[model samples]
Target chain A: MSEITPEEHTQDTRPAKHSGERYFGWTSHPKAGLYTFIFVGVLAVGLALADFFVHRHEYIHLAEFKIFYALFGFAAFGGVVLSGWPLRKLLGRPENYYEPEEETDNG
Target chain B: MGDTLMSLLSHTNPGFIVILAGMLAYVIRGEIPRAVVTIGGPLLGLAALVLHSALSEPLATLNMMDMTFVLYQVERVSIVFGLAFLIAATVNSIFALHNKDPLQDSMALIYAGAAIAATFAGDLITVFVFWELTAVSSVFLILKSGTPEAYKASMRYLGIQILSGVLLLMGATFIMGEYGTLEFDAFISEGEGLSLQDDPGAIFLFVALGIKAAFPLLHNWLQDSYSKATHTGAVVLSAFTTKLAVYALWRFFPGEDSLIWIGAIMTVFPVFFAVIENDLRKVLAYSLNNQVGFMVCAIGIGTPLALNGAAAHAFAHIIYKGLLFMSMGAVMYRVGTTKATELGGLYRTMPFTAIFCIIGAASISAFPLFSGFVAKSLTMSAVGYEHMTIIWMMLLFASAGVLEHSGIKIPFFAFFAHDSGKRPKEAPFNMLLAMGIASFFCIWIGFPFLGGTEFLYGLLPYRDEAMVYLEQSLWTTDHVLTQMQLLVFAALAFIVLNRVKLYPPEKRGVVLDFDWVYRRPLYHALVWTGAVWSKAGPAMTGAALRLSRRVYNRIEATFSPQGELSRGPLSAGMAIWTSIVLAIVMVLALIVGPH
Candidate 1:
């Protein structure tokens, strides 16, 4: 096994000199995000439509309503993700927040 | 002689054999020999577990200090957790094949062995022994990172773990005092465990297990240590400690009521923390907390189906979570950090790791046809059966939360988000093989008719309940469609959020957690107290010394013979008065004293 020094580890993050090789380049295309969003939107709509046709035998009464899970999932996930903005503002610290400064100062 | 040897092997605790192999690995010189012992030990333990004679009975016992210690007992629950541990140990050894650190190899095996041993222990004393051993042995993995940060984190980790072990010992002592024996069979019966309210020891045991299980507020050691451990060390560390706690919880406090709320809170709180976290491994640490919450909740429900759910989820979680950690470990191996801000577009080079990571993400997210879906269904149904609507809703909300951080964020930011232009090489072959094996189990157990679910369900404590659940509810149209609806909408929400710029971008920072209360305020308080003592201690001591000296000088001036009494020669009047006083004292003594 080869040992990776800290210097080498930092250096590895830089773009490789031999940059010709590429795999899964399509994922980097300009419109990939748009395409992904459209695909997921279509799937969500389709699933919602399927919910009306399928009978849900639910233990909780509110879940029997059509597209309840769809709404709940979308709202719950979005709520959690959007909460990140305030969570970060409230809790975020510098990358070196926890590092002991005395050691570095003495050295 | 052959028959005797076989009998010894059959009756011996598989963990001891694995521990012996670990000791052998320490002295072994060659790489191949060490690797053989490291990987082969767990395999041999699995064989021993299979060959053990019976369930719910002690296969081996020892008489010590006028007490019988049941050292090796195979129960249905034990087999589920033990098999998973042995498999994980082997997989972890394979994953670490490239790193030839002998100490790590030995300690990893020993840590794993101790957990398995504790799982099979029928008496609390035996459990306490291996419990501390697991804590002592596993700290070496974190120390192998060899960074100041890793050192600090490992010490904190060790402290918390040892505290948990101390609590367990205290609880065991209480049990021994209350009951004449400490054996599970003697005190706790088959289906029912000790009640937290009814027994003093149960509360101690609950808190002890809660700490190890990373119950809500007591969970910082996990995120702190796991993110700092060596890449391979994180993978090994993830497999044992908390799962052992869960096994203990199941053994001792299956139906405790407070665990229901504790587990619910455990599931929801980490999701919020994980969302804003930058380090991908730390995100997974939170995700691990969330996943375990489901099992904890299931155990709290404590019906046959729920217990089965807990066991089945643990078995599946040990594999998929290990796979996730292994994938990240591979990333750390080539890239040196798992922070999301420092990683992206590596899927171009490390495609195999990306695929395996996605599989693991999907499994953890409880996608249809995944191990998590099959395992978690029983718990959900059991909760529903009990009509615990509020708790069920909390779990449902947490399920979507799992999809956000683990299912989407891990793979997205690390592999497919905006290109960071990093082109590190693909993971080593051994790592890929380990991940491949784990991925196989995820799909095999998750998909129907592969005999994987059957095998897993068979190992569950309540096989009948699990089998019934598998047949009646698992693949039902409503269940499948609703799950699909939940997951699809959740994925759609992610897309929508990203499109609308609502999704938070990965940044370089640490998110503050409960650890900050200690790492900041408590730490500063101690430091301040020390500084005050350093400044004031000598002053206080000098003042005390000066006061004592002043008193001594005063005594010498006033009462010493040279200072007062002998300064003047005895006057005649004084001598006459002294004689008169002496005569009066003699007369009083003679009058008052018994003749």
Candidate 2:
């Protein structure tokens, strides 16, 4: 009887790349990522300051605070991300914890 | 002649045509015919909707069990939902064209048709029938995956869906008993929502719709089943079931005050779940629940603007959410897994799918020039107009949450994060075409007054109310700036968190939800009970048998014929003496009585 070996997984199944195939490849470059992050951060700060010039009609009393939208967005997102750590510890189970097998739903 | 032709078409149920197409698709073996039936069916249904809308009222009424069932109801509210269903069906068919499974193809059409049918159904009985039909047909999509997990998940999905249908029927029966009519017009006042105060049945009806809408605790079925379905199946599933229930809620339980808080909870909880969820499809499912929450809240408000918001949100949600699901499905199709931990930097290969996914994410997150902004503005404004400060704030928080989980996380982890060392094929052409069409709608609906027409706002149930909001403008400088600030700041938070290594890493695991109460501990409990029963049953049976045998021996020894009296000659002599004495006493008594 023959036995299957685990080393076979090292073989690549992807198609060979050709010129002009990688449309968004630059996104992965470290320099490009840093520049992109800086650009987005500046844009966010610019928008947050622009809120003062734009006379927004108040809906809630909290909206009166300067940079409220920005702060709220930051806090809301931060809360979700930070809280997820505790949530994962409380709730996370192995992928196969619900059943014995993984990737069972093959066509 | 036109009038006569229109009347003939009006008599036809659009859903029936879609069902016929499904039947034809099932019978046909060839690919072209199947695709034609799949795509063409929804187009024909859309045509039928146009014809039905020409008629001013319900047509094709059926009499059964001494009650009137309005099989076709064409009204302003129903038309929007029906149209959305048709569009979703067409797009879903196109998305599913590459797959050759007839069972899934047919079931998808049938499920979409059933949802369309339920939307146009004027009576509770008609709605109930089509509601269950949607459940029965859609389960096949999950089952068609042909894996044990798919099978189990589909069963669970079917069980919850059927339970919802049963509750709906129970509610409808109560309504029928009280009102003596099953026609929707009788129970729900026109323009006013179903009043629980007037009819207790409305409560049950509300709960039924809540379950189908994946409200809060009852929502685990959506994540569990949808994440397990086939790629095409997930896309198709995203379109109809929950949205149909939203439509039903709008029609029947609008203005039910409790839905406000309920919807608020629905919107917020899923964001946390999505944040921790590993399966990309499951994340989308959680996102779907959150989006539906916005609509449900709008429906609960039940004002004209709010209702319009609900209707428009449903319309936009179907496309954008479907696009999101389609993109994930493509990923799953090409790579065979949608787990966030297992996928990254696929934008290097499947750039088109990645782009479409980003568009879907932006639209769902309500970017300034996206479809979600136009549609969601109405609801938020409605909430503000009503001075529901807390809910308005929660919705704001949820909007940020949406940006975190759906807008950024989906595209970032799948496309731009640390590259996993796997490259797969680009998505097939048909999937691209489907995504393109949905993406076009997302943009087209976002910029109002495009192409010399009011795009999405015109199709809303309360057109005038929506137009008022549209006139006030979704693109106000303040509004756009504020939204941009919020969204951009949220992105910055992600970037900062990542730089600081404060972001939670994606891991392969299941997170506990309300479903854990049943799927885990309850299941284990039942197994334990069965084990104890199997072990203890024989011993108890043997003990009972031994006791019964001992009782039998005692009875035989004391009272049987061979035991004492009849076994000895002395016993025979005693019996004879007793008989002689009795005979003498009788003779002496007789002689004395005569004297």
Candidate 3:
């Protein structure tokens, strides 16, 4: 068995060389570029909503548009609920919840 | 002439072909080519589909208590499901080609055949028989993993499945007693003008269907068992049980009001769980729950268009979901695991696998021009037609949620997201081939003029309305834009969340879910039951026996002729003399009264 075996359930799991931060495949990314993406995504959504209203039908209900606000609010609420309570527990370390125990001899 | 004709006629039964082939394969294990065994199932299914009407249900009775269970019915919905099961069997057998477990291979065929037979069953009895067969046949795949966990999971799976069949039998018994027949055609409670909810056995039937459908809290068995099975076992598990539940739902409760809300919740809750789930297979199981939610909602809608959507979604889901499972199975094969946190950077070598996984992910996420696109849109549109604003938005949100996990997280983590520096080899040829066919169907069904949509519609409960909706307003800019916006913002959310590092970092901890309550607490309860049952059993029985013995001894001592009562005969004689005097007095009084 590999070194990282959990003792109770006897199944072999592939060992991780360095788990604390395997860099999680971020070796190629510039960390600052992500901030650019966040900014651009927000700007793009805002611009698109504005364009849809102003260009599509020429109808105006900007003051009475509570529906869209409610929708976004619920979406945010759901996203938080999902990530806060369950995400950590649900997505766990690796598939080997059980690993083989080391061999021992009494006889 | 009679002998020749009879020999020609006996080949019409599909059951014979399948069981015969299974026997033949086992006998000719080393002699005959493997392709013959591999090709045997679909060919037999096709031949059966063609000649079933000419032949009778074999070794099965349609004649029990005036209830004839027709083993083969060419109904539209059954046709769709049966066909899907057949195709899935072929695909699955291919995926398992490089694999050599005789138990898994044989059990898979038997399970597939049983599911098909269940689809064609004409009576509740036939359905029950095949239903049990499916449960029994399927556990081989799980047990073949040879892990203690696999054994436990298979036992749980088989237990739940058989329990479901028992409930079905109980309902069928009640149904048969009330109606005097087990034939599965439409029934209106014998003579009632309207089959009211208060009808004697309707609730029992509904509960039975609800369990199989994985309604809300009853859903965790799926997440638990599917996660623990062999890679190929999980794939085979997808095609049968829940869809069979769907077939029964369509048969029994087409337009029930409660199913609508139940179906809506079924679609929604799993999204949260899917988002947080660790094992990719389990995540897909939750996603599968959410998709089944759509079908259940359609079943609730019970409109022709909605029913079509339900059937079509089940059809499309089986393919794409199986595709996802197959790809993940391949990942599990190469890396020896499929937990998202453990799997990454496999894209370096398994590009084709990555691509196929992405196609499955996209199809399931219901991206425009995917099979899920054409099928799921019908159900959502049906909700809109009903003016159910809240359910509509929830389903729309769910579609986005689907994309985040199934579309992005699955392939992204397993293949690309963060390379774990594990340079695993590519998937075996058969696994890739299986994924490819499933992926092809995802496109073929979604693309225009592919006859996939038409073929699907042809097999729906309500065909005409769904076809018209598909023909009209399907491509309108408003509809497309709305769908695109929901998906685009969802995609944007995933990207933004990832960029800002707000997305939950893949963690290595057990996430408690509804299953935790059952898996742990209920497990404890069973242990307690066993403890209590064993602890109390002897004392309870001993106390009852001792009390009975004491009562019997007292009766024997007091009333026996040779005992205390016989010795007291003198006292009894004195009492008799007193009674004689009283009798004389009463007689004298009666004489005086007459005078």
Candidate 4:
């Protein structure tokens, strides 16, 4: 609802003032980044702890290992993200890879 | 009055009300009136569905072409899909409320209506009619973008959709020919519903649904068309077409073993494409394909619990996927693009959209308390119970992949990544309302405390089986712990990768998909053929002319009156020889006749 234009907004790459600032104020703060990391790490570990407390009747044999899901989740996600590098190398064409000349026209 | 109302409702096709509202919307000019009709149509259709839900049998049948067409079947399977379709229609209408285009509004309604209609269809002929209607009506969503690219993409989308419809009809024909009926009921074997064995017709039907479902290589149409659609059009487009195919597959090919491998491939490949995809809408399209794979695999498992899982997942998926698309649509509406390479720091200006997108992402990623967890658990457990070790592993891999592409990448890149310095307005109030509603359901359905799991379970076709599984397995400490472990660790992986700067940066480019075969090489090949023909045509024509002239000259020399027989002395000698031969023959004939 604010009447501010893109031009009028401050050029600071940090947080732009909005209601989002009310909730996500710390995201822009460099020191708070560590807190965010810690929060996630603690949550991941706590869930892993549940592995010891909760006995899972799993279908896959590998799933019975301690924190198996945790390790698998971490590895699978990392693999997908890291695989992007190679995939891009193989599949990445210039911006106009599909329609080479059209990008310039649109741009 | 009550009796009369009940009787009237019995004959009414719930889907027709929505379609009629669409038709009515075309005639209205005012934004408020059109919005009312657009939103109200689905609401009324939802009401019709509620009114008709008590009737388990076909509420009414049409005698057309000497065959009975069930216009309104309100069985458990149809009810689940029907309800989901109605909810999606209502939500999408709200998302698209800001757009004043009557064409987009009407087409969206018609598209949704056709899907709902097809859902309630008890016979193949009825399914075919609505199936093609969905194809024809939905293309305008892409076309309404009014871009040349969108126009071309719409044509491609339309072509594939119509091809699916054609194949479906062909399958129906074969089924009818073999079974002496086109009723969808023909496939039920003693008690198992619609099992596809070695039937040739079922294979055709499977391929048709696969095309719509974007089964791996057949998936290019979804990304191509959806990414190019008008902002609202994309939101509306996301809800119906592919999910309809999923419903159809659930109906027809449940328990077919081939679906297991096909579904596994579906879940894995899209994750990679989505990772590298530049268009946010296109990424969601890939994510949609991946999610459908889970449902498909469950259907392949064909157990009661798995089938219930597929149905529940479809119901939930329609809402979440639509929400994700709406969020991206809002971004495109405000900023004129959803390319991740060009978008960042949008949460500064578009906080609500960002939040909704995250909710959608979490739901799709199967966060422990989201809608996906409740729905997907049934399938995963069914897989485990069946001892399909390898397929289960592939599904596990896909689970992590979903978190990577749809769950994390979407929000991280578009809203919170490196600031691209693009400040856009928050989405309109109507779009926010739609997203808000969808996000609420995303959380509501999966939270065990919210009773959504029970409500959704009650709607399953195999209700007793689902409830038994629910009682035994749904909220076990082990299941919840494992799910949380899987999802949280995936999040941990993303954070670590981001900290290490190992995540691939989004860039502008078209990654080649199967569409490249048709859109690029096949098109270019045709163009090349045309060019070759153009270049070589005249020379070949001239050579043919020269050869004909030589043949004409030879013919003239050999048989033409003026060229040889009439003008040359050889003709006179030949005539004299012919006369001598004839005279001798005549003499021999006279002697023989006398003898």
lDDT of each: 0.90, 0.87, 0.72, 0.86
- What would the TM-scores of all predictions be? 0.90, 0.88, 0.82, 0.89
Error of 3 at A24 (Å): 17
Total backbone collisions, model 4: 0
Per-residue lDDT of model 3, residues B1-595, tens digit only: 9765444433333533454554555445553355467556666665566544432233334455545657565566776777787788779878887776666777777777787778777677887888888889888878888877677677777887888888888877888888786766545311111132676566666776677778998887788788878899899988777887887787677767677888899887887777767789988888888888898888788777777788889899989999999999998888888888898877767778888998999899887778998889888878777777777767766776787778778887888777688877778998999899999999988777888777776666566776677777565555555555556556666666666677777766555666656555676687689779799989999999999999989988877776566576775896699899999999999989866
Docking class of 3: incorrect
Give one digit per residue, the lDDT tens place, for model 4 in B82-191. 89999999999988888888988998899899999888877888999999999999899889888878877888899999999999999888898888887666665311
Off by more than 4 A, model 4: A1-16, A100-107, B1-5, B53-56, B189-198, B538-595
Candidate 2 residue lDDT tens string, B404-514: 889988988887788887688789999999999999988888865563126677777778877777778566788888888888998899988988999999999898899
Cα RMSDs, all models: 7.4, 9.3, 8.8, 6.8
TM-score, ranked from best to worst: 1, 4, 2, 3
Sort by lDDT, best first: 1, 2, 4, 3
Deviation (Å) of B213 in candidate 1: 0.5
* Interface Cα RMSD, each model: 2.5, 1.6, 7.6, 1.3
Residue-level lDDT for B538 in candidate 4: 88
Q: DockQ winner among the candidates?
A: 4
**Which 10 successive residues of model 2 chain B have the least lDDT summed?**
B447-456
Clashes of 1: 0
lDDT of 3 at B155: 78
lDDT of 1 by residue, B1-595 (tens): 9788778878988898888888888889799999999999999998899889888899999999999999999999999999999999999999999998889989999999999999999999999999999889989999989988888889999999999989888898999999989999988865588887777788888888999999998999999999988898889889899899988888887887887888889999999999999999999999989988988998898889888988898999999999999999999999999999999888888888999999999999999889989888888888888889899999999999999999999998888888788888889999999999999999999999899988998889989888888888899988998998899999998988888888999989999999999888887787789789989999999999999999999889866766664466564467778999999999999999997
